[model samples]
Target: MSENTPLPIVEEDDWYRDHLATVDEHGKRVWIYPKKPKGKFTNYRTVVSVILLVILFGMPWIRVHGNPLFMFNILERKFILFGSYFPPQDFHLFVLAMIIMVIFIALFTVIYGRIFCGWICPQTIFMESVYRKIEYWIEGDSNAQRRLNNAPWTASKFIKKFSKQVIFFSIAVLVANTFLSYIIGTDQVLAIVKDPISKHTQGFLAMIAFSFAFYGVFAFLREQVCTTICPYGRLQGVLLDKNSVVITYDYLRGEPRGKIHKAVKGKEEEAAKMNALLGDCIDCKMCIQVCPTGIDIRNGTQLECVNCTACIDACDEVMTKVNRPTGLIRYDSEEGIRTGAKKIMTPRAIAYTSVLGVLVLLEIILFATRTQVEGLLLRTPGMLYQKTDDGYISNLYNYQFVNKTSDTLALEMELIGIDGRIKWVGHAPIAIPNDVTEGAVFVELPPSELQTGKNKITLRVRSGDRTVDQVKTSFLAP
Candidate 1:
């Protein structure tokens, strides 16, 4: 430990570190054929994925207060959350919602690693649970798939490949329709489906493009989406720490691995007597076989690992068969595996949680206080007040009202502060439709109530007995 003593140079394992598992030194794509995984964790993930998928697909169809529960019509700058309508003016609420979601995801990653990517991500869920299952049914397990790929193009191969493609294409179309529903509402999507291609050319083309994109993603560009494309996967390196719980391999117990053999049956006692070194890992390689990302869990926490827990299940099954303790791989933190210390509430995690909590509270408050109607009243440009024969000063104004609710509203406007009478130019009571209504009105106030050339007027908008909105504008006076 002396200062004069030179530190030893350490060589890094560059083979696996230099390139992606799905690529080779020649830069060609190395297709992965992951063995189908099954265990308690996979079963739990399946249930969760199914529930999330149902919500994603069915939400567009569910109506709340006669409005689609969730719709983001970006083309028209309109968005609806729950039953509340948000126009271009309410874009702040949408931005706030997005910020809340980002903070929530960051906090979750700081605490629990990439559990969301593995269990609830739509890409993973549809790829593994749906498309991959279909592939397994048609092409069998990894070995069979590999064999089919290596074999010549025969009738059997053609039939299997063609059938799988047909089904995959159909599912992709369905997924595209579901995705379009979220953007433009299910009713619009149904109209596009029922009408001729010439009627809705853009929508029809969009549907076709989305279907092919989905097909290419699920069938060809599967794991690359997570490893190479997704920004969240790359962000794990910054968000995760020693305390973050992830699917980790217990290298302390499994290192210096040796293959199991018949000679090792009674060798445990002999090794113990001689102080011989031997670890629990038998090097079965089952974990690698079941990994969708094609990375070895024993190499430590890699970006490719989605925290899927497939390695844990595979390793546990192997350990049980060999009469060794399970959990050679498990859901644990780096510190837990290295020093046997489990801690979830680190200082960084606490900070993230605090910020996330505040954002969520702000969102709730914003939604609760949002008005059902919006109104804007302004004096007509370059217009002067006219003194009527009755000694009343009248100002010409234009009014615009936006109805956020689903029902038609017959609105009446009254001056709030001073004594004034509101007279609609065309109608006695202005009828505001569900979207937007514009009209002109004349506000006549007694000269005794007028202050100066420029006066502030408060207008109250009412629907029947309920006051809906209040708007303030400048009134011109001589």
Candidate 2:
């Protein structure tokens, strides 16, 4: 800790250090303006972005049994996943599903590192491919973008800047609508758009709020979301190990690094010096220039790196220009880079895989054991047992119907145990909502029907004029 002691190299570990732009001596949030990336990986990412964009935008309309395959209607407290309805009563199931998903993500991250952050995540897909591309399109590449920012707002600058904002805001609005569709369902989103002011006033307002936030995030907020905001990104240090494959610089091959051109003699000497002191790296700073998180990979693994492969592509291009073999930077573990170890299946990875297997089995078993039909019978409040003309004791009972089915059910309720006659107040079969429980009526009979002090009464509900659900209740008597 003394001034005489050299600062130790910052090692990446369980705790993530601040990878933000604005930070105090105590790690904190600061703004960052990342240089837009280009090269092979960026090209691959663009293709991937297009595919993801289609899937994201298309998901709302993709129907499962005429319902959205995915809808989390927080407002209605109704969740429909893959056409299976989950009401408030299924909250335990929802919690379990969430836990399973979180564990799956953790296991995947432990094995493969932050490939999700770079490749599959919506944040990265939108920011890197959509907004960043637009930024590059309007403001030019990194250096020109820097220059344009520094330059005053002339008519030319004003128009270009204005155009970018207009585009950004437009995209945000589209994104907001798509995002809201997932929460409120495609039908509600359509109602908002089609009916506008009259049908969905609150929903319309919510859409606007979401759009503005998305705009702010993609435009001004940018990389801070990954560096400072995202908890998943923060979890990477704990989830990832030395064996996890990450975007890494091969310092052994590329270090003691100097410009390859600078060390050149003529032809053979140029190649030899290029192979010697300079390694393969041209020191073009292209990798640094393209990084979205803006931390140098050559400085060793840092929390800021998203493993987007921008550096790999950039370095490969540099190698190509100098007629050298590529991969100065690649997806590799620190051990792999140092010891030339390939990405073999390790003990830690096997353990994660085993855990994942167990989780999958548990999920399957839990799903398989779940009941399809359920019922609830409640005694009508303030109603006592009544003696009928035929000496039959009648008890007024409220019956609830729960049908986890796609088809409309016509349930025939029957009271079983001892001698009893079941009659509905309405003489109609019990019917329920498509994905909800409906309450109706029933009356049970016979004084001798009560076998015990408090008899066990069973009410059976039939789906097709046959018994499907059976509910047990305590029959009360003096």
Candidate 3:
């Protein structure tokens, strides 16, 4: 800011920029019009929306092994992810997964800034691209919505309002059902639908709860979901830097704006003021109207702005009409604008991206290395090895098996490392349940192989031709 530059009439206190930038003169949350976005970025957003829709709707239908590709049964403390089965014993893996996720989010925010808030976040996706677009279609654009809001009660108004509510709630319900599919699995969701109401009271209640929350949040809370609710939005200031790319006003190019008529049209001396001196902007306030968060980008970048680029489209439209070039407002940095420089890939960004890449690689490695089947063998406490009538030293042990695949497996245990032979006390081989762990079995070794005090042994469990699990335990010998 220069000494010649006039102070913002919107805020004129004896201080610097106000922290509460988005509040109106009355101190209420300023409602924004956000003139329908167009141009290159808007087109890019459409492609992303389609990809998200497909992934969200397709995940529950995907099956890996004999189980849903991903299912979180918190009630049972069981989870089947990818093709691997996990029980309570695998909780450490889950904790590690969550830690990785949090770190990834933080690192991403530190570099790319609010790209997640504007483009990738589910709340923004559903609100800006999906729900709001639907509303615009049904009720007409922003100005029409303003008129309808002010218009006295009428049949047309009633019809439009009723239709919007119905559609909003309907979509919310569908979203809830799709969300539930991830939790309980598509098969179970289908079962709940097919089963009698009496059989699924809890499921029905859960559906209701999800529907109400989704509907209320989208319909009523709306943009406040990002501003007031989202913890990430609150954290943007700390995560963001002046070098980060964000939707911003090129103050050097756009400042000293004046009315079109006052811009001096024909006279050579006056024409220079309109052409080169006066700047590209005409200060029509088109950008202000299109802001979702209702903060003027011209006031410098603020936390409230989600960087949706609605202002860019609106400003571009204004510039085209006024015979001036666009991008007075665009995805640029304050530093870039001040120095007349282009966006740069700074070292901070590179470092953050490198960290993200490493995290992703580690996640992939962990997933790949996860064992398909879980096996454990432990000697029964306070029990000594018994000599069987058949001249075998028998030791009671507990066996637990987790079948990672979709199909049931018939498995058998074998002994290795200083053992004569392995035999189950009862059943020779047992059927392992699919997507679950079943506990059973006892191991016996020939007396000829038994040591004095204790013998160390390795037990291998086999399914088909594959060695699914291996366990090491001490065999007690008296």
Candidate 4:
């Protein structure tokens, strides 16, 4: 290249791609102190957070048919959904539900970006709305917080910090207890609190561990949970595309950035000429100042962004003050910014939605068609056919019954397909109540109905007059 040739232009802001906004170049965490956000969007998010928090803390206590509305007792292998009981036998339904959830999240992310993280995620809700709000109340806003941290260790600072820590830890404990209730039931949690510590030592310790974990996450980890720890944040690179609607800086309308300046006393023509070259943005960094994750929205979308809309509120305020039309930073897609069009139903999103719909429908059908009881019958181990005096071939079998309802089941078993008589080894019928029942029975079939080696047989289990379950097993013969 000759001296006359122009040098290629390079983007300085592209450096943001190499490192997280919440981390310094040394790989150490950079604490964020976002200015207290105030705008219509912030208010809307507060309402939503309040509603979600209420639902979360209250769900364990909400009962239907004498059981929690929703409970996932993984320890006992019991799950209750909307008063429906599911034992280990219904694990397939649980698996299908998880698959459906994954597909739904993919579909939602492809079209709407990480709105879930910003609006409904429990982490963001507690950090921004709960803990952070409390901090702001105790220590004042961002500038005040910075000053307090940077100041010498005085009694005032110690008192303020101590009070904040106490409140933060208290909230963490409450959060831990609330979540524990979801897993173990509110009654169990209350029992652990009311009972002797020696009797519930493990549960008490678990609650303490969870409390400290929550405290550390909200107090220290903060934005790192979204930027570095959460897999959903990392997934943005793969899930998001030009068509996805996300919290975006309208670089097309706000670029060629320059500060807004008043005209000089006499050089009005020059000032007007310079103003013509500038865009709506006045180069004020209010967006960056209000960002929770500490990224500049003007740098374009990055993984650390949680779509919290704080930047949108801040930018809109700045724009309004500058007499410029608002929405310099707003919810939009790259394609929409470039072409002035938005398309949500892309092929990828449509495909994901289709798959999600099918799975959800299948889940509903399976849940509706699920039996009240599930039974499993197997031939007794190391036992063979016994020839009876009545010229019948007998096989000893062990049966396990899972009751999936609140009511006790008086179940009677009958042979199907093969002409056989079921004789209970211990009891005549099985009584299952809210748990599993194990028993033994002898299935006797005439030699005419027996096969040479293995014969397929079905057992119909009935509760009163309704068929609750049907189990199939093989009968071994001579």
Candidate 5:
């Protein structure tokens, strides 16, 4: 319900909580035609969206040290972040980084309610700044859109609707390709595009599916994603409190709302008395008209509120026209609106911040100290020590090396403490970028160095005279 809805005799204030603003009492969806929003906040959000979109589209193509700036190739168990290559061996680091990000978002939410959703969320940016703006350009403003929808299907209506869908799907396709590039690398995505569809059927189908999913989200789902599907929106009820800064209507300054009126020349005293009883708000419903999620700012904070600031701009514009001060709807905590005191550093916020800081630091340290190459040396499972013709004891072994660098690694291994020589069963492995190399080798030693059951052996692994890893494993002998 909005400002225009009639109040019920009982539970009038609680009615809005009973159902979503986009749902009717009969449980059907109420289509919203939000008025095109303008003002400083909208302009600012447009600029932010443009920058974010540029970064989102550009990141996959941007390379650092021969690696994509960011990649998470789960298919190959390879990940490259910034210029650093992380094989499956560094999965721990990736998990830690993810944890840090989650904690940071939670901390931000505790201090500023849903500001990320309004200003930085990809959903809000694409809906409000890209797709919705294009919709307004094609269908005109909210009134024109409503009228066109209500009117029977005409040639002009069909043309506008068709043109909008074509553009929306085209953009969705582009976004899907960009998203795939982040997962599989830009070169792979380009290969899929250049290759025959039959050759890359799975990749081609994945791209098309992703495109359709995105189109559905922007074209039809819209605000429902935020209201019902997003876990972050649901978390707001637990994360937010009276001290959290949000887009709030100043009930102290805007309550007892009445329509603006002019006084007659002789009845100025009566007009003044009437004005004294009213608040600054004129009940124009402009705030509701501009809200993307179809919420009334006058009803205080709700689950549907994204802190988009469209209502703020609309209310400010109305206030300016009516010769009243602006900020009827603006950024403020509930406590600030009631008591005029703003406090953002609550105990929950501090705790989350502290945990986030430690995680970030731990991630940094782990990344800095991580090994460039890792090796796993194991003795062959079924083989026992064999006697060589030259009076030497030989043990068969298997070795695996993980390369975490951009360059190829030609590994060489030698016995560290034992007097022995390594003979490759076939050839020693040459590790490639973000790949694992495995091989079998024989460690031959004199009988003096052999133990009765098992002997401790140390292997020093090197690449072109530079030590890579020192691995210790058990060598079996009879």
Candidate 6:
């Protein structure tokens, strides 16, 4: 074909585009039976999935500075990340961290498409590597699995189905326990497991509920979690652009597709001539068969595509067998495939990157400057100034101190500005517990040093010689 010559137009009915690949015209679910993928990329993904699984299941048991490495104990209104504890007072920091994570995900998605879903997502890792592999082992390949599902209730089919169910359920239970450990702590989880069901009824029920949810998702829901449920998959339309690198089919090199013909005795020259006019693609549908989400790469990028690179491996294998160059399906932007130009640093992607960097830096600064103790001082309600016997006006105030650190604090309140006295109702030096402490104190100021009406007074909370926290409250004065 000449450069000036137009490519052949392969027109087909657009009915397939009207609905999803995993659903029928009546909106019923269409079960996908994807052929097991095998290649260099698959092996690499297997290694990555194994590492991620180890981290996921082991993180709750791992401790840093006597605290779980990562935990979100929402019930107790406490959270810990990398050993740093975040109480309810520091909830804003958690919100900021979540926002930063969102920005990072957005930036990554704009540059790399949905590679995270395929490579690092927990659901994809467990489904494809663990559950799917087990299914293949017990029920054979895609064809065999389909046949077994469709066949009547036979002893062989029953055994395979029962075995797969048993394994999936057991794995789901383990997954649920690991998930709960991150929420309630591993020690509590172990205690619940060891204790009787009646002793920890709520925890037992929660574990059972989580186990069933996981089992249902991996066993029945499957790819619908990505295509229909997960918000990240839907966000691809907004986050991804033409410059984003994704698994794509090189239509420019593989189009005008034709089947390979065997060399015959009399038609050697004819077959060679025919092959010269055809593209590298042999019209093999191996790419479609290996797709987990059941979408054809040759049809262009679709929402159902997970960017798993399974199609790339499958297409490459077919190309090798046919003595053709590989990469009929590969990781390339749509712009690269269309204009033969690949650009990674688009303006939108750079803007997102810059915003994400700023957010991360701000979060780091916040964490660095955060105080270990929080103090609150407020004027007592419905109380006026009391004239003291020493010609001084005294204001009764309520104080609350929260200690975020693990150690207790010996706190003493001191007036910051003018010469004044802080007389605690109970004792001279107050001992603040690890969590929270509340008390009342009277701040007495002489009339010569005080202004009329309301006056601002600063109270400094000191532990030994170091001022740990400070607060300002309005004091009633005449």
Worst 10 residues of 5 by lDDT: 7-16
For candidate 4, the C-alpha RMSD (Å) to the true structure equals 4.0
Q: Backbone collision count in every prediction?
A: 0, 1, 2, 0, 0, 0
- Higher TM-score: candidate 2 or 5? 5
Stretches of model 6 off by over 4 angstroms after superposition: 1-13, 427-434
Please give the lDDT score for candidate 2: 0.77
Q: What TM-score would each prediction reach against the true structure?
A: 0.93, 0.87, 0.87, 0.95, 0.94, 0.93
For candidate 2, lDDT tens digit of each residue in 296-405?
77877777777788888888988888887888898888879878877747787787778778877877786676555667788888876677798776677776665555
Per-residue lDDT tens digits for candidate 3, residues 272-383, read 5455556677878878776776667888777778878778888888888887788889887777778877655677767767876787777778767766577777777777
Off by over 4 Å in 1: 1-12, 264-276, 428-434
Residue 168, candidate 5: C-alpha displacement in angstroms: 1.0
Q: Which ten residues in a row have the lowest lDDT in candidate 3?
A: 13-22
Better of 1 and 3 by TM-score: 1
Estimate, for each residue in 84-182, the C-alpha lDDT of model 1 and write its tens digit: 778776788889989988988988998999999989899999998899999999999999999999999999999999999999999999999999998
Winner of 3 and 4 under TM-score: 4
The pairs that clash in candidate 2 are: 22-30
Q: What lDDT is obtained when candidate 6 is compared to the true structure?
A: 0.88
Q: What is the lDDT of candidate 4?
A: 0.89
Q: Taking the tens digit of each residue's C-alpha lDDT, what string does model 5 give over 1-478?
A: 9979985654766677776889987789998899999999999999999999999998898888788999988897778989788887888998998898888888888899889999999999999999999999999999999999998999999999999999999999998999899899888889899999998999999999999999999999999999999999999998899999999999999989998656889998888899889999999999999999999879999989988999999999999998899999999999999999989899989999889888998998998888778988888888888989998888888888888888998889998877888898887778987778888989898888877888898989889989888889887777
TM-score of 6: 0.93
Residue 355 in model 4: lDDT: 87
Candidate 2 runs further than 4 Å off: 1-36, 196-199, 261-275, 343-348, 369-373, 381-393, 415-419, 427-432, 443-449, 465-467
Q: Write down the worst ten-residue block by lDDT for model 2.
A: 13-22
Q: On residues 309-388, what C-alpha lDDT tens digit does candidate 6 reach at each position?
A: 89999999999888788888999999989998989989998898888888889888988988777888888899989999
